[model samples]
Target: MRLFGTPTSLKRMVPRGLLGRSLLILVVPLVVLQVVTSVVFYERHWDTVMRRLASGLAGDIAATLSLLHRYPDPDGQAWVTDFAQEHFELQLDFKAGEVLPNDEHFRDALSEELNDSQNENMEDVLAQSLSERLHRPVMVDMAIFARDIDIYVQRSDGILHITAPRKRLFSSTTYIFVLWMAGTAMLLFGIATIFMSNQVRSIRRLAVSADGFGKGRDLPPIKVEGAREVRQAAQAFNLMRERIQRQVAQRTEMLAGVSHDLRTPLTRMKLQLAMMGDSPDACDLSEDVAEMERMVEGYLAFARGEGTESASDVDLVEVLETVVARFQRDERCAVELIGLYTASGERRQAPTTVRRDSIERCLSNLIGNACRYGQRVRVHYIAQEDEESCSIVVEDNGPGIPPVLREDVFRPFFRADSSRNSQTGGTGLGLTIARDAARVHGGDILLDDSQEMGGLRVTLHLPL
Candidate 1:
């Protein structure tokens, strides 16, 4: 249910990406299982094997020393060394005047990176194994040599120095075990990634279709495929879309019926007024009928909406220019474009998809309202660096709408007073239509005081 993240602490620790989070989901337990198995291996398998081997070696050394001590002659020492080498596979030597040192060196049999921790733990394991069996203190040096370790023990006469391969202490098979575990984790992660990617793709497609629907654009039907939950969601989306289509069709039909019924009566009223033309009473009635007709048309326009137009890429720069040009021909107040040109050069045009005529109508309504109420109008485009959206602001210098009534002005046929109404000559549907059009494109129209114009500024924002 949480989109951006889960619980706050986990949200921060985990990566903010789909694949990264999925891998973390897979890898955390894999690492846990590997750690558990490794601990078991060291405690049960590795320790048991090393202890048995070290015990045998320690017994052989004790026996050989006993034989040499019992004889004590040069010939007896020579015969003990030769016989031990041939029979017990022991490489033993005596240093007549030397003694075993107090200090001992430690290192891992395998990796150097693990030396610090492995060296201490392994040295303890080896020393304990030797002492428990042989009942003698042994100096274990695993670091001084590359592939072998030196064992030194002092007797009353001299030091017995023995060299042994480090493999006797630890098996190489552990490395193979680690490699296999790592390979299996990666394979699981890869399989999870493939499935997750497919599921994510389906969700993204559903989101795109929903966005397009909100923006009043018709998109192809989305395919329902993925897990059971995703398929159910897609099915619900299809049903909702169908319901909306049916409602739109019914509304369109009703509007057509209403237009036909109302216009037939108006046509007759107009014809009757024309036959009684020129008389003062008749002229007044004609004016009233014309005003009524205008009101009816405004209502119909607002009801009809932007019509069956599809969205397309529109150049807002050109739209603003054309609207200004049309106002100029009508001899309205001079309107200038700001931010469209800069001292460095012409600004880059930001492209956005919109219903062309819908935006045009919205702009024209705002511009006309501005020109009627104000002497000067300033239009500008604002495109921020991130480029998520663009803004078209039309500012005019005139008596601005009161802050309280600004919102009220957008209501259908809600004129503030006679002075404002007579001057603008509107049914008060202009702002309503403009705002509705903007909203359909996932944009909005906002009215505020223009700092430069000291009047109303109507800003229209459309997504890019």
Candidate 2:
């Protein structure tokens, strides 16, 4: 029910980048101005100039014919020709006792289609003026001469032929005007492109810096450049990044203090329990102390996962193999290490820049959970080089998480009834910590049902 398909479709047709749209904004008006100027010049200035030049030439030829009629003698005719030639720059020739040809014969013999619209218009104007003044047949042949025009005028006794310089009827200013207009437009457009690109470059650098920071990659402060608004934005971004970093540092310090304060009492209680006799109550209290220690460890690990670890180029395959081998050594669960493969079925190593410790911890948490819940664990590495990303799929052959509760399990300290039960003995922060680490590297962890393994499929996707 819309003339255009939709607003979204129209938006797709427009340039998505700022540089391209800015150039478009600059070019559209310039082209419209040029077109309007050219049209005005052609319709008013060009037409008026050609008409006046043709009329002037026609008046001179008319005067020559009148002088010839009055004298009639060859001596007087030669004199009139000399006078007209000296004054009007028209070369005249008179053929006595020769009849002018009919319109059909004249067109067949001398008429030609002129390529230039200006020349054609000039020919029409000159031919009209000559016919009106002489009241006789006039044939204008513009193509007969390269630098001159041949005009045939019917006289009382014969046909009069007049050859006039083509420059007299044509103005060179039109070409000069068009050339200057086009050249000026091109030069201005080039200058605009250069200036716009420089402005856009500042914005581009700001964007890259922001993205790197978001991905947990360390980058220097963005240099404020370009227009006032862009520089303001860059300054604001730098301030925001500093504020976030300060807040994170403060949080980490507070957590460190809290861990020390809690662990001291827990350690003292453990010492007391060990010193006491092996009573059931003492054993329960010890187990409770151990669980508290694990909860504290989990909290500290979550905080440390987002620590100030600079990114470096590391082989993802090697890290994945190492984690799989460590789990394989446990021998409690079946761990299968699948080599990295591209979509083309070729094995290749994935080398990407990421925080090595964060990525290793994320992988360890995922594998450890799989081993705890499932009997068989399969780690499949898929490298998508073209997309600049790689995916590590950790699948298990245990009672898979229900699709409805899959997302809930990722919440901190949240557990599902079926698989993430208390008997499994988890602090319920494993998936939360793993996902946080993945996101810090500009990646994500997705949970779904494993079709092949008939259990949970945890895919950790990271950008290269």
lDDT of 1 by residue, 185-259 (tens): 789878988888898788878888888887878776789998898889888988888887678777777888989
CA lDDT of every candidate: 0.78, 0.86
Tens-place lDDT per residue, model 2, 210-318, is 8899888888899999999999999999999999888888988888898889989999999999999799999999999999999899988877667568888888888
> Which parts of model 1 have CA positions greater than 4 angstroms off?
1-94, 104-120, 260-279, 328-330, 341-346, 405-407, 418-423
The TM-score of predicted model 2 comes to 0.82
Q: How close is candidate 1 to the true structure, as a TM-score?
A: 0.80
